[model samples]
Target: MAVQEMKLREKSAPARVRVVVEEAAPPMMPVIYRRLSAESLRQALRKMLLIRRFEESAEDAYMRGLVHGTMHLSIGQEASAVGICAALDPTDYMTSTHRGHGHCIAKGAQVSRMFAEFFGKEDGYCRGRGGSMHIADVSTGNLGANGIVGGGIPIAVGVALSMKRQKRSSVVVSFFGDGANNEGAFHEALNMASIWKLPVIFVCENNGYGMSTSSDRSTAVKDVAQRASAYAMAGRIVDGNDFAEVAQAAFDAVERARQGGGPSLIESKTYRIRGHSRSDRNRYRTKEEIEAWLARDPIGAFERQLLRLGFITTADIDAIRADVEREIEEAIAFAKASPAPSIEELTRYVYSD
Candidate 1:
């Protein structure tokens, strides 16, 4: 990292308060683009930093015996969730999976409350009712994170259906992993979305493996995007590690959906550096595979691209890192300081909060 990038990470959150004065917007790419101005690039980079910091923090806490349950970190694949989310409006809906921390942050979820929920506090998104696998912020249009793989796809279809019925212009983005493509629910949901021409962008994040099983062994399709043809929808494969590609793909899909062009599938070919879960030994794959993916670290790659393009200084990235670290620390403090839901409060929301 350059000196300027270092400074950027150090002053992360404080810089966000300033207004971005855009003299002229950069050219938009229908397929892929990383041509963001310095300020916009900084903001996007900060979000990726935030997600990386947040998940790593949660993992550290889990190891230290702070978090009580399972925690799936979305550390390596931050670009897939964050960049796509940047293309969305607050009114648009998205459904998440077990590895949902990145999704939550991308959907504008409150970081402090998310931490509170992780700590089982009363102020959590689910008010402490839902734990790690069930975080939900309805206000942000993040339908609760599903515990079951591929479970949220159909639900997102339904959400999109409602948007269609109401003519709301809002589209539902359904994010599932490569593992989900093998599931029956994924196929069923795609079928329905295809038949109805519902505005749903099915983003299959092909992170190479489905738990312990390699996607190569799990499915015959070279790319999950090819399956969209069977569903009668347009499909495209993208470099998921590239934020520009991700943002462009999402923007194209979102605009098409808004224009009532129905569903599309985007296969974001990326990798998850961590194990399937916190407990994963990660020995199922070879060291070379891990090292290869690490070489293409999405956040680091984007940061380099931004710097080379003169869009970000090293100071910007460093300031972002520090602010993200502090934010995570503050979240930890908030979660620890907040009270656990009272036994009395448990029955409260069950009836009426």
Candidate 2:
């Protein structure tokens, strides 16, 4: 009987396999023509390209020993900066992280002046006093980029409080990294903003690493968005490499804040192709990991999407690249030619002056 049972079990027909077909994820860009106009798409592409070029130029200058201080380049995170800024009104306020040149550019700052600032010229923003990490443009509504980790979060909340007190419809967007999420200021600011119903959007650009430490090692929560639940605010995770995804999420968050819906946390999953800063040798990450992300280059992927949608031709993309290159060269020339800050003006803008 045992032999017979074993034979039956061996001869039994293979169990029926069930294959579940999961629904495909949504496209990076909206399919409806009316939802995203060709002009707007083109502008997004241009803005992203400009940022990439500007960062490349800055990196080159730094390598040549032209720049005195260190700079944090947002080489692989252009989509996050451009997409979020594109969703904002010109009058809307934004606070930036140390890696904020892209934020300044997306917020309508001129590359010439930015270059001048990096070169420490008198014509630069902040009159050349604030270098790469501290560039600010009040006219463009950028409060300033903070050098301290998690420093800008509180400042953004304060700005939102001020806006609320004034009854202004504008919202504030705060850009910070995954590392900042672990800071005491992050929790305090978010709690206060939530309790007060401040009009603020806390955007976490989770680029996988905080300096040499991986976020997995530092953050208690797997997804930064999960923290929003503690504060009873809306939280969303987005593909930071996709411009359309980031833009859509940003639009909704901005609208919510403007309508007094209080703060929303957006965690954009992006990667920094470059090291944390110019001084980093990139010994922390594997070469294979870097190659994998480089293949998902946001700008290249977006260009392909634009071509496929017939919004732009190869020629159009080439022309845009050429124009941006020319602009970058001109900015470099302008920065080099600009005079340094005068000794007489050294103490001029200081508070004690």
Candidate 3:
């Protein structure tokens, strides 16, 4: 009976064995798309649009003598501002540079109040005391915009240390320019932040030229992010014009910091299409250079990306533009209608109450 069973088994095609292999899982989504919703992305685009339009309107207002004092217009670097801020929670804190109107708007400041600040009205974020360079909205977690280069870096370090002491899960972002990278404060702040493992993100908005002195002419290192090694921290560089790229880098750094992984140095390679300040004649650069940067406009690049991704249509862009225009008009009207800080109380906000 055993011999007969063996012969029967052998006759059944030798009992062939099959091996199964599973295919690899589909690639994970891009960081921005994975972490942020479609609505968040749309709001990002809207914020970028808001920054661009607001800057243009502010320039017009400045030209028409409606605004006083020189203002640093961020004209072409909207993506760097809005993209980085998109990764932040409303509770997270940030400090800005002189070129910070974009930062203010990206952090959820009302354009009407921003315009009011620009107009030096009483309803402004600083109650007209800060003006264009000193806009601060503590309620929105914006520490303030620093007129001094690299000034915010140390401030951010202190804030981060405070958060650590209190055991808060918040992080502080210090937004500076390429010019600030050379400052002594920057190195000291980075070193301290790294040693203490503080949650601070040092964002260098390297817009090629630091007030007409090209970074190539000023910075010893090819890229500012390379400086991270000195402080033993993570360093990354992204095309500051590409909103998606900027958002991804910022999100990764933010997450790392929030999780107690320490600080990061992100160098955003962007260009400012406008002169450094209102008084700049732009003679330090050429028309061709300006045109090249303008062609690579951050807002336009982001808009194109949104349209291609089906996040927004041309009509959506048009409607957003219209909505922003109305908002700007309304902001200007509000500023014009708002009262100015009284002369008798000129020192009202000078000291902490």
Shift in Å, residue 160, candidate 1: 0.6
Model 3: pairs clashing at backbone N, Cα or C within 3 Å: none
Name the candidate that leads on lDDT.
Answer: 2
The sequence of per-residue lDDT tens digits that candidate 2 reaches over residues 280-334 is 9898999888867766667776776787768999888877877887888899999
Query: Stretches of candidate 1 above 4 Å error?
Result: 1-37, 351-353
Off by over 4 Å in 2: 1-33
lDDT of 3 at 352: 81
What does candidate 3's lDDT look like per residue over 124-153, in tens digits?
Answer: 898888899998788889999998999999
Residue 32 C-alpha lDDT in model 3: 72
RMSD of each: 6.0, 12.4, 17.0
What lDDT, from 0 to 1, does candidate 2 have?
0.86
Steric overlap count per candidate: 26, 0, 0
Could you estimate the TM-score for every candidate? Answer: 0.89, 0.90, 0.90
